[model samples]
Target: MCVSVCVSHGICRSLSLCVYIYSNTHSGGGLRWQMAEFTHLVVVKFKEEVVVEDIIKGLEELVSQVDIVKSFVWGKDIESMEMLRQGFTHAFMMTFGSKDDFTAFQTHPNHMQFSATFSAAIEKIVLLDFPVVAFKTPQ
Candidate 1:
């Protein structure tokens, strides 16, 4: 977890916030996502009646159709002792090269369309845009 992203962006406005780092390597092979200078993290908590699977599929489709997103990945929470999570269960982290790129993504018609449905299902959300400072990789 990388705290700097959340802190620098004032996401959750705390240093102790849990930060999830994006993986460079692809799950199927060694191919890596194009390295970007910035990363945007989005965590969402859906309402009780919201179907989690539907939300995941919508995100996958939205990202697949959006070129502005340099890379995208998501997963569900397993189990954690940390209590700050506040019942948030799903997270999506996407990487983009520039603020302009991210802005474009935010305003994209496709994204806007997707958000209508996504937003209605979400109960709460925490978003963080992280600027890469320094990272270590396997040697």
Candidate 2:
């Protein structure tokens, strides 16, 4: 599980604190025990002018076919072109119930098909997988 706090403009400080605690307790796991953690944050970048809707549809289909993905989020970077240059046009935040679930996602046929579709529009892709450390409050 993961917790994301919005620190964007106009968010109240108290509300942010409340959300922080809620996110940590629910998404990041409660004080007693940790929830199932994911081992990676899979991010994909597409070329400019690519059909985003089609890619999202493909991803949705892939997710439906694969049981390994416990939860996920996909979206385009709406910040700026400079941010886009940093890397990745589309980011897919996926949570696996276990390492085994991640492994299954790697080999799943639907994933392979999705990759094929994704590659067609994407000029480049960057994949990063990080090991999970102890959970902390979302910054």
Candidate 3:
């Protein structure tokens, strides 16, 4: 049997060795545990004339509509070395509580609706999904 504990976002672990550590504060002012968070990462190169602000707005709307989304962030590339960028100018990352949660987000109606518009604006895109692991620092 496996067991785990949660204490104000402090370290928690299962007997099977699934471990979690605190990383950031939640909106309610308590530290949020690392948990088994799964991340959805996307890098994109937009077609010319695509307004970036619209993309950001649509993505933000999805996070609001999807309860399973734990956190969301996006940004434009600002790398000084253009050679390394490979023409991908923007990136988005979303964190879900678990792999199951991530899957739910994928099929969620809000996601489906948003993806249609989002995909059309992209000239090129790459997506990666993974469980967060191996943080460099511990709290």
Candidate 4:
């Protein structure tokens, strides 16, 4: 099972100890070994005036220019009952075969350029990198 806890800055020291215990028991080598690959969930909150079409256009242009992006899916937020409450207006789910592939994407010039272009349109952003643990169904 995967779990995450977001903590405020002041409580980080105390929360980190709890995070460490949970991570050590739940996310060690044995857990990591079960994954097929990992994915980076790039969640972005756009400015009020930014439309979904504009975001899609920007992402299409961005992905076309980047080589390190193995595969990606970009979309607007959907209604959900989950606690996260779809805070981000847009989401880009990108998959990489390995950590090296992801690292290359992070440092690639194309990505940097894209970020420069896209950052001005965003109000807030959050990125969560999660490992693929136990895919019971075939991809």
Best by TM-score: 3
129 Cα displacement, candidate 1 (Å) = 1.4
lDDT of each: 0.71, 0.62, 0.77, 0.63
Top candidate, metric lDDT: 3
Model 1 score (lDDT)? 0.71
Residue 134 miss distance in model 2 (angstroms) = 5.0
List the pairs of residues colliding in candidate 3.
none
- Candidate 2, which ten residues in sequence have the lowest lDDT sum? 13-22
Better of 1 and 2 by TM-score: 1
Candidate 2, residue 10: the lDDT equals 34
| lDDT digits (tens) for residues 38-114 of candidate 4 | 58987787788877687678777777777656578877667754467556666888766566778888888877877
Greater lDDT among 1 and 3 belongs to 3
Instruction: Compose the digit string of candidate 1's lDDT tens values, residues 96-116.
Output: 766778878888999989989
Candidate 1, run of 10 with poorest lDDT: 9-18
85, model 2: CA deviation in Å?
3.5
Clashing pairs in 2: none
